[model samples]
Target: MKAVGVIVEYNPFHNGHKYHLDETKRKTNPDCTIAVMSGNFLQRGEPALVSKWARTKMALEAGIDLVIELPYAFATQKAENFANGAISLLSALHCEEVCFGSENGTIDDFTSTVSFMKKNQQAYDHTTRQYLKEGYSYPKSASLAYSSLANHDTYVDLSKPNNILGYHYVKAIHDQKSSLKAETIMRTSAGYHDERFSHESIASATSIRKALFSAERDIKEIQNYLPQSTTKWLSAYFEEYKLFHRWEEYFTLLKYKLLTSSPSELANIYEAEEGIENRLLAFISESTSFQDFMEKIKTKRYTWTRLQRLCVHILTNTTKDQLKKINENPVATYIRLLGMSQKGQRFLNHVKKDVEIPILSKATGFSDDLFTLDQKAAQTYLAIFPEPLRTQLLRQEYAKPPIRFNEEQQIYL
Candidate 1:
């Protein structure tokens, strides 16, 4: 069966996500659509607004055939590594195509950039290092190098976050020589950072989260941009318990981690960089909040988001050595199922024996280090919740079955 893959966060499944899913299915006409979604923590180095299970349920309800968790390490890394990990999983799943939403890009555009990068890799590397030596951040240096080598305006086009991610996805596929077709659905509405609901059925997830978490608690505004499935589940979820999580909520623990840890220890965390440990130590004493700490350490060589991820690495005790060890192993030893539809179950059964990695529906009986890290991530996520609820949610990760939804299947709503 033909299957299309998508790498998603779906922090809270919004109207725009629904539109993308619809367009992807229409374009590919795949027998199944599979997703590798971030769990608990997101690429932005912040806690998700809701649990991964809730988001997986949203994806399955809104038409995804299968949802698999993108383990914490890759999900929270920079775009290049993130794309590599996601595409690696899709390739392992034997997907024929991978579709992503790009604001102003076509498949040819991404393919050309990938080809250009591969052809001019040596010059690109030299130029990038020169810029980094001159103190430009890795992202800025790489963009400048690519534009220079390509001898065109590829830089401006690739500077956009979504387009850049799309480029990385195509590049990953190209590097692996995987037979996965890359497709892009042009974004038709609100921009990525737009903090307001837009006309028609489109709205950025950023806007939805902001509106929901604002002081006034604009429930109607949020409702307007969410699909019926998301709205129904999310509304009930909100009424029953708190449904918002922010980086600020964990700042205290992060602060303590930084203050107590020695410079040598801080330097060993993933993405800590050459001199960042000293900068972090200097700022930890003076900065009052996470934002303030980020501002004090931010430089042309390190963007705030990069620094934020490093902080999360520190908080999670994800060391550089540990990351290296994990990377040295095969790319995803296990694919953890999150949720699926009846069609998805059939798809899994069809490919189960042929799949490259172990397909796990539950976390128990797993001794994989990567899997252990995923559980650790869940533990950190649960730490933010209140006492009894925290314990309850922690148990749910191991005990909860992969949510299955179908016309004939009887399951909890």
Candidate 2:
């Protein structure tokens, strides 16, 4: 059976996500669509607005045949690593094609950028190091380097979120020489960072999330931007959990982690490079909130998102040594099934005998170092939610099976 793959983080499945799914199927006409999604934590280094299970349910309901978990190690990294890991999983699963939404350019445009970067790899590296030496953040340094080395206006487009990820997605396919074909669906509506709604049905996830968390906007208004299934899901979740979580909710725990940790200890946490720990330590006593602490630590060399991710590493007690070990063995070790439809189950059965990675239906007998970190991520997610719900989610991962739906059972969570 032909299968197409998508890398996603449906923080809460919005209408735009549904559109993308439909478009991918319409364009590819694959027998099945597989989505490898971030769990609990996201690439932006923040907790998802809802749980992974909730988002998995959303994906399955939205028309994805299967939803697999992108391990925590990959899910929370920079764009290149994130795309590399996702593409690797798709390759491992034997997907024939991969599709992603691109805001800046067509597939050929993204592919050309990739080719340019590859051709000028050495120059790009040298220029990036120069920028880094001048104390710019890695992302900024890379963006500036690409612009200079390519000597073209379009190269600057690499700085945008969708373009950067799209570049890396195609780059990974090229570097690995994988057989998976690449495709892009032009972004139709709300831009990535847009904080307010334009067309309700096509609003960005960022905007939808902002509206969900804001006290001023009526939560009922959120129903407009999301699909009926997502609307029902979110409403049910909101009623039970009281409120969806945000990274700010973990600030107290993060502050405690920083205060209790020594400067030396902080330096050893993942991403705490070159005396950043000392800077973070200095603000431990003075900053009262996550925003305040992040602002105090922010510099030309560290973006807010980077600092927040560092904070996550600190909270999760992920260390430099631990990450080094994981990075050394970067190939995905297992396939985590988050949810599936009836077609998805059949697809899984067909692929099971040939798949290289272990297909795990539940978190049982799995003890890889990376899988352990994934468990830690879920636990971290649980800690942020209220009591009964946290316990419920924890149980759901181990005991409940992958969500399955069919014609008779329209939706099951």
How much lDDT does each candidate structure score? 0.83, 0.84
Candidate 1 regions off by >4 Å? 151-156, 196-200, 328-330, 407-413
Question: By summed lDDT, which 10 consecutive residues of candidate 1 come out lowest?
Answer: 147-156
Question: Could you tell me which residue pairs clash in candidate 1?
Answer: none
How many backbone clashes does every candidate have? 0, 0
lDDT of 2 by residue, 1-413 (tens): 99999999998888888888999999999988999999878888889887777787778878888999999998988888888889989999899999998786478888888878778889889999999999999999988987776745555287778888988899989988899999999888888888888884789888888888788875677887888878877777778787787878898888788888888888888999889899988887898877788888899999988988888888888888877887775668888888888888888889888998888888877788888888888788788767787888887776666777662377563
Tens digits of per-residue lDDT for model 1 on 160-227?
78988998899888877789999999877888878876666778888888877788875665677888
Error of 2 at 287 (Å): 2.2
